[model samples]
Target: MTADSGILVLAGTPIGDVADAPPRLAVELASADVVAAEDTRRLRRLTQALGVQTSGRVVSYFEGNEAARTPELADALEAGSRVLLVTDAGMPSVSDPGYRLVAAAVERGVRVTAVPGPSAVLTALAVSGLPVDRFCFEGFLPRKAGERRSRLADVAAERRTLVYFEAPHRLDDTLAAMAEVFGAGRRAAVCRELTKTYEEVRRGGLGELAEWAAEGVRGEITVVVEGAPEQTVVLDAGEMVRRVRVREEAGERRKEAIAAVAAEAGLPKREVFDAVVAAKNAERSGA
Candidate 1:
């Protein structure tokens, strides 16, 4: 690629501690041709903290201006300018405002690279005491109650660990919703103010965590919920019918009952229905 062939550099800013800033971050911040920061004021503080002076032009690239500013930044890169992107914290585009610019750069044949750094997702997961062998990053849960509950229900049976970002004010309600859907006894960890002075990681059943969060919480919150417990016994055809019957007796319609049982057993609803029907036929034949 030619020197002026435009390059997009995404840098990970320290989530909390300035000491975590990598040497390469300082180098790029000072030497890049253009720097796009989520918050220019925060960028100034970071530069000052790192004792690094940027010779590049600084521009805001937050959620509000990301759409309008994207084209301008892409043009800079196309002109062979080295553009560095830094979010307010954590990696860009992880529930932040870096995806659009990155996508724009890639579409225009601009080179894209990143400076590896601290990540709250990884940090929280590591310290969550939950299974990390397999996990999913869920970013932030939906804001509205109905939508949020619907979304949480979708993952209620997810077997892999889940990581999510949540606002402080809504932590209690979110945790409560998680408890209602995922189960009151499901284990979880809430890592708050990670890498900061008041950092805390609370681990407990979803029910207890909900109660705790109800008291009060502050700062950035990352939740790591343990996956559904491993099922020791696979549901045989007969057991599947019984499970569906139990749900049906509990006031669920037959269709909804089958679906609930199938979701719990990680099976298809049609499979559960056939099993229940087969069991009914066997009973009639024996009679």
Candidate 2:
């Protein structure tokens, strides 16, 4: 907070286009006392592209060495050095390496700031033609089929638009899983190679997208999925009790059945529980 205090700058790099780099990024890159990059080679290429030469020491700070390098960067910051962190693409710590350094710097009272620039998440959402008013960035899904499906199931009922980053090779499988879990009729958009040559955005139902990806998709991929539709059906107490009893009869525990029925009815779990309880009490009184 003081004039002499060191600062940690999390610089956002272009996802695909170098020209999109912010002007402050070049200044920070050249003047920082230390530059910690996810990939030194990619940093070199970026500096060359921006026509800027780093006046400070450059160190590799990637997933493989993030833990080991964070403290070193924190030390530099504590010593009144201006440290700049840049990932291979997008903002640092966004499915990239920079979170540890930021946390370390913050814990040490070192200032942390960012140079805002292009973001693939925002870019894809902007172009996806989906509702962006309320959205969440899921980052990436788990690679394993079961884990991935489980992850999808967690948000199967999310009403806010969802965004995700996925690798090229796994696009087909991911899309297929999404289709199976999110429903084939669910609308989605797959953005590939944003701001670069061969950039493409395919929009369709999950089923159609899965088929398209089955043929193979190349380049960086971002997927935007439409949220679950608003529940409109009004379930009376009797209906709620009936649904829970059906699930319970199908072998689900009472608690889980009530929760599932509540979720499907868009009602509080307590409401469904009360309904079931009332129904049982009424039946016993009639007996």
Candidate 3:
């Protein structure tokens, strides 16, 4: 923490739009004694766009070489050279590289700081209609369906809004798994290419969004799902029937709908089925 020791700066970059880059990022990029970037070519492009000249020695520090590069960067920091870490987008060490270097610096007692910039996670959450007062960031799900579903199941009862990152190619499959594990009626938002020219935010129930993603999606993506109802919210018969009807309206069969609704509401399928039947019977009697 002494002035004799250099600082490790973790700088955030624009996720999509270059203009979103902050002034502090430009200053860090230009002033650091050593710059460790996830993508050196991308860093070059960034500095060119920002009209900032990086006078320091720029080196690649991606996942592949971060282990090998950490010690070298640590040596520089110990020698009183300010080291700046930047990823392709967003903050380094956030579902990205730079973790190794940061941990190494911390172990060596080197000070660490950050130049906060645009973040896709925060941007998506802010735009998502879902409640953000309490939320969990699940960076990405497993590539396999079974593992992904199991992961979703673990958070099935999570009461905080959930955010996730997904590849464009796997967006459809991920959304489908979410619909299955969380129920089709669960509300979510899919944010695509935030801050970009084609930025799009699609908010709807899981089933609807799954259908939309099935047609294919492109660009960077972040998904935010609404949390389960609070434990205090009573899932009465009428409410149970309403949930079942919502799933059915989204193309689920009545029997399948009943099971999903029951699971989400923490009730038995028999109870959901009875409630649905009674609601229908009452409607018929009224007619």
Candidate 4:
């Protein structure tokens, strides 16, 4: 058997509490040949907490410098360096800047691994009291209102629970947009502060949450929305097609429209697709 090449270790740090840092993380930090941190200052603080001295070289790697730094890191890994990548919080390259480096390393056949520890996505989903068996991480929505709403239109039918991260100031607008796109009665939970003091989880319908958010919310926020309800065979198929067509006309592609319709109508994709196709063909044949 062949030995593995140098590895890219993606280390996940704590979101709020430093004590939450995994014990193995410190060992990796002390032993790694190259420590790539989002913020060197924070890395120093973490090292201080861990009381681990790094004998290897330490370098800054983040959003601004990621593109330029990737090749350098990849070279070190190629030279048999155990490259350890850490972000400000949570996992690296997860809505963070480590993707470039990871991609470059993977392309060169460098082994990639992780010191899995804290994750806001799973933490929020776990504590949100929503179904966690199946879910999707949406990260963050677009900042603009129109773009955000249009994006939400795609997941309106997602049956497996949905999760998202949102900014404090934009919480109200985001909740309102979700209410409009996902429906007023859709159940959701907003988790804030995570594992820190003042950690909060607000659970309610999209409409109520929107109203509450209008008063303002603070701290890091993660929102989990219940998937669209399953369709009852008795529901109107024609109505579902009409609604899906509306979304399609609003810049959503046919697949997205069909998905939305299927979710809303609580029907299978084939059923919705057949109805949509038949409706289009009927207009073409003038039947």
Candidate 5:
């Protein structure tokens, strides 16, 4: 690990419109000692559009080469070289290759910073018309349908807005899977090619979005879905205990049964489990 190295800047690039590029982006591109770009050609075009000339050493740093290049980039940072990392679009390492290098640089005591710019996560969430006060960004789900559904099912009861990025080819399937797991009535917004000329954001229920994508979608996709609403129930402690015991007797694990009973009773798992244990003790005394 190198010491007292220069700063590692994780700069965000525009996802679509060139004019969306922040003023500081060009300056950083021009001044950094080394530019690790996901696509050097894209960086070249970006700098060209911004009318900035980069004299820095520009090298490819993408998924394929990120592992190999992280060490080199860290070394450059340790050597007091200003290494600016840029991805094709959005913040580097959000769902991109810069995380490895960023982690490496930080571990080596390199100063790490970012030029916060465009983000598909924030952009989609903002325009999705969903509850943005609290949200979670889930980069990309597994490509397989079964795995995707299982992943989404894990968050089916989440109360925070959910955000995800998907490629066009898999957009339809992903939306369908979301509909199945999160419910067809779940509200969501599909943002396509954000900030570009033909950019489109379709806001509707999961079922509608799935149908729309079935007609074929294009460009980068960002999907934001509204969170589940809170449930209300007034079941007594004895009933809660009996429910968990019933499920547990039916081959479900005690932990899972407890969670199921909690969800059914509209109470926290801990609260429900405590009640269940108390009920069990009372029943044992009676027996």
Candidate 6:
């Protein structure tokens, strides 16, 4: 907060259209003592588009060199230099670089501020036709098939709308995984090339989207999926046993089935296990 201590400004750039750049962004770009960008080439294009020239030292601060560069930026801040951090798009550090620099700045007791601008997550959610009342930004799914499926399974029962960023090439695989884990019938929207020419928002069930994506999709992609429908799960022992059996019939091991059912029903695994055991004993005795 002292005049001798510099401040870190996190500036948000356009996700697609260059004009979405905020007026304040230009001001910060022009006046910052140092400008850190995710991509120097992209930053040049942006500055040219905005008709503004950065007067300060501009350096790259991407994932590749973020760790090494953060301390340097922090040192500049401590020396009372105005540091502006801008990513390739959107705010720095949403799923991009800048988190490390921001943390370093904070740790050094430096002031931090931001120039809010366009966000793909918000833009996709607005047009996705899915419930946005409460939602979670999942960033991106794992690239590996098994890891991605496991990640999806972790949130299969999430009731809040889900949003994810994905590469065009991986769209089909990601959507297919979603269909398998979140259910083929689950509603979703695929927003592509947002805020740019040829922008498109495709809304449908996960299965349908997966099919469409299989044919090929291009450009930046954002997916918004409807949350799991609320279920009136009876907590009785009979209901618990029935749920476990259903999962077991679907080829899940008994232990996995019990754990999954317990998670879905918001009950302890031990409770579901006990119910299943009790039901099996009763059935055996009755037979």
Query: Best candidate per lDDT, number?
Result: 6
Worst 10 residues of 5 by lDDT: 259-268
Model 3 accuracy (lDDT, Cα): 0.88
In angstroms, the error of model 6 at 67 is: 1.1
RMSD for each model, in Å, please? 3.9, 3.6, 8.7, 3.1, 4.0, 3.5
Candidate 3 lDDT over residue span 203-282, tens digit each? 99999999999999999999999987654446899889888788888987677677666667666567778988888999
List ranges where model 2 is wrong by over 4 Å: 1-3, 234-287
What tens-digit string does per-residue lDDT give for candidate 6 at 100-208?
8888888889999999999999999999999999999999999998778767866777889999999999999999999987778899999999999999999999999
Q: Could you tell me how far off, in angstroms, the CA of residue 121 lies in candidate 4 after the best superposition?
A: 1.1
Order the candidates by TM-score, highest first — what do you get? 6, 4, 1, 2, 5, 3
Scored by lDDT, model 6 comes in at: 0.90
TM-score of model number 6: 0.88
Per-model lDDT: 0.89, 0.89, 0.88, 0.87, 0.86, 0.90
TM-score of 1: 0.86
For candidate 6, the C-alpha RMSD (Å) to the true structure equals 3.5
Q: What's the C-alpha lDDT at position 270 in model 4?
A: 78
Ranking by lDDT: 6, 2, 1, 3, 4, 5
Compared with the true structure, what per-residue lDDT tens digits does model 5 show for residues 125-195?
Answer: 88889999999999899997666765775566678999999999899999998887677888999999899
Q: lDDT tens digits, residues 189-263, model 1?
A: 999999999999999999999999999999999999988765544799988988878878888667666755665
Better of 2 and 5 by lDDT: 2
Model 5 segments more than 4 A misplaced:
1-4, 233-287
Q: What is residue 287's positional error in candidate 3, in angstroms?
A: 51
Per-residue C-alpha lDDT of model 2 across residues 1-287, encoded as one tens digit per residue: 55677999999999998999999999999999999998999999999999999999999999999999888888889889999999999999999899898889889888999999899999999999999999999998999987787677667668899999999999999999888767788999999999998899999999999999999889999999999778765899989988888988898678767766665665666888898899999999994
